[model samples]
Target: MPHSERPSKRLAVVTGANAGLGFETARGLVYQNYRVVIAARSEHKGRAAVEALLKDCPEADVRFEALDLSRLASVRDFAAALRERETALDVLVNNAGIMALPQRELTEEGFERQLGVNYLGHFLLTSELLPLLTAAGAPRVVQLSSLAHRGGRIDFDDLQGEKGYDPWRAYRQSKLAMLLFSQALQQHSDAESWGLDSLAAHPGLARTALFEHGVRSRALVGALFRLTLPIMTQSAAEGARPILHAATASDFRPGDYFGPGGFAETRGAPERARMSATACDAALAERLWQVSCELTGAMWREETTT
Candidate 1:
């Protein structure tokens, strides 16, 4: 039998699963008996993550596939390959993201680095994978947003930041875009009767490699963050709770956003978090959806597989 025709267990894909919250999300999904794919840009790190997962649960169904969000071609190729091998995708965690980069950089496609990798990349990936997701009885897509989204502005005039670039501003826009995308996707799904759930989540100050190695890590802000880690941060596993909940919970609405439930939503169990006025703007989401589709040349697959 061809690989695509073979019967298998429920399947999931978690981008950036090589470490941090993404790894923990994959771990939880594997334990739940889903055949999880650890999608990351680095083959070595991806394989290592698979190894670590298997070490804990030797029978866990998990493997790695290369996916570099910085390149739109890579996103397309990854989606195409997965479609050839899987008849359905039960869950997709858009978890991979690059935090603040000190220097202004552009992706292979000339997109702002942070926006390209964090939001646009996932946008295209989810668009490409729509067919596989829709084939499942109940599919779910989880987008990773952040607290920083509150300060985000779309800045359509300078989405690429050609005029001016501030690391945190770019990061904020990307995260807010993720949240807006989640809501927009849910709306689209409802309108098209896609029968899929789309939700967003935030980790609420989790201490992960992204924080330790990102732009903030180099300055006094980084020092302060590190100093307050014990009191203000949670582990990656803790951070994954909101994502896992958003991905698997039955009671959540299609467009709900999840995050930590403690004071200022810094750390606690998963729960519905507050949304910024900008994030709730349906008009903006629609505009972004159109712009993203134009930028990535993404077309949501309308056909469904049996």
Candidate 2:
């Protein structure tokens, strides 16, 4: 249990907080005095992460909760348990994700693996937790997008990648969906007066386990990526800066996207990142939102949007 549960302290839930960028983000939040819930799939990893967090900050208010984003039931169960314990949720960083799989895969629900874990799971999780988010006077939700989104296109006809599949293509599409969802959610918040702030951010080539997990060792592409990674990429702690900024900064507007500000957006400090024309397409965003509701059976305001 966290040492302090002061009412004045804001509570934050960071998905994938067991390691990498998510862990760094959680640490940053704790430093700022926010009580954090480290959401992850593995109990061992989650508990170890909590202990590591305490080791760094003995007074830190942080704990682990089981949340496997690969399964919809787990997402719901995680949210339900959280709602039972906390009346309001101040921040939600949809940071959990898996990278490119060498072979195409599907989630238990039969959705494309990348799309299922990266976008759909977070979409449903956000929907289920909307009530708690709204209960707070002002709440923020941050979606982790990627530079890969620039190369992504929403292939509605092959969203599940059943017709054809390319590892990087599927991964790109999922990230693009995340960016689109972030915008659409902000628009809905504005139109419906939900009083929620929705934002998106990218890490700009952060050095993390994602590269190791996503790429094949013998693959030439993976080799090249690794060779250039140290030169082009920043550390995971640096990567989490933009996400933290979006989650806690007072000057950001709803729907703003942030990333590293150095050359090519590879490193430095937080700055407004560029958005692809497709990412800025309002019509495309709305269409994707409707499709996501249908895919996940996630209802907004107790009802799915048409």
Candidate 3:
């Protein structure tokens, strides 16, 4: 049988898999016969999501694991748990993030909440799981980015947003970080022969819990989002297809971006996503990677399967 047609025992870890795009991604992977571990912040929701997936694909091999991306301790703990439970991990989907909040908030590690959870947390987690990923031979890492990254400007000095804070800027910076970091990681993987495929993607406008949270935080923006979401957004399942493609596609190209190809790249089939010129800055990505290492105390260079 062809490799794609053969049954796969590959194990995958998808963060924020309790709902929305993450849940859909997990469901799709499980349907492909991949053993999926749904990493969610809420165990109840995680189990619920697994049950839902089972309902859709009763034969799917899926389970839930607890993870809180806003906390570095949580990231470490979650990774440690995975190490105890499994020897190798084939795919990791960094698909959980927050959008524009009404006010500035900090994560458990004192970094800006959005940046901490969306980029730094995932960064630490990925580094922590490098050993497992490498042990799995051919592995893939998919970072969830966003269209907001086009307008994002990383303020190196105020990375924590101590001086001033803008919700959109913070969210965009985190998303842009995901984009840059994925590309940089792919380059590093090639240099080290890590046998890892790193990719990034956006979901355009998807009808997911993300906007529900965004609306709750800021009523005015929420109203506008509510007004426009029905007309512009696609289903959560449709939005997750980009991530599913990045993870399951046989081509295995690193840094390949994917998203919807319809109007404004919002509501169509999965394809190459658009990004800003800044998203291609290797130097900036390196700097951000360095700073992330400093902040999270996760030294990716030290990671090895042996």
TM-scores for candidates 1 onward, in order: 0.96, 0.95, 0.92
Q: 21, model 2: CA deviation in Å?
A: 0.4
Superposed by TM-score, candidate 2 places the C-alpha of residue 277 at a distance from the truth, in angstroms, of 0.4
**Candidate 2 similarity to native, TM-score:** 0.95
Q: How many residue pairs clash in each candidate at the backbone level?
A: 0, 0, 0
Q: Alpha carbon lDDT of residue 164, candidate 2?
A: 92
Q: What would the per-residue lDDT of candidate 2 be over residues 1-306, giving only the tens digit for each residue?
A: 212343778999999999999999999999999999999999999999999999999999999999988899999899878876887889999999988887889898999999999999999999998877887879999999999999999999999999998888998999999999999999999998889999999998888899566766338877887788877889999999999999999989899999999989988799999999999999999999999999898887622222
Could you give candidate 1's per-residue lDDT for residues 189-287 as a string of tens digits?
Answer: 999998999999999989888967763645888788878889988999999999999988887988999999997898999999999999999999999
- Tell me the lDDT of model 2 at 72: 94
What does candidate 3 score on TM? 0.92
Candidate 3: stretches off by over 4 Å = 1-8, 215-227, 301-306
Please estimate how well model 3 matches the true structure, expressed as its whole-model Cα lDDT.
0.87
Model 3, span 86-202: residue lDDT tens: 777899999998888768999987989999999999999999998778878689999999988999988998988889998888998999999999988998888888889999888
Q: What is each predicted model's overall lDDT from 0 to 1?
A: 0.93, 0.91, 0.87
- Leading candidate by lDDT: 1
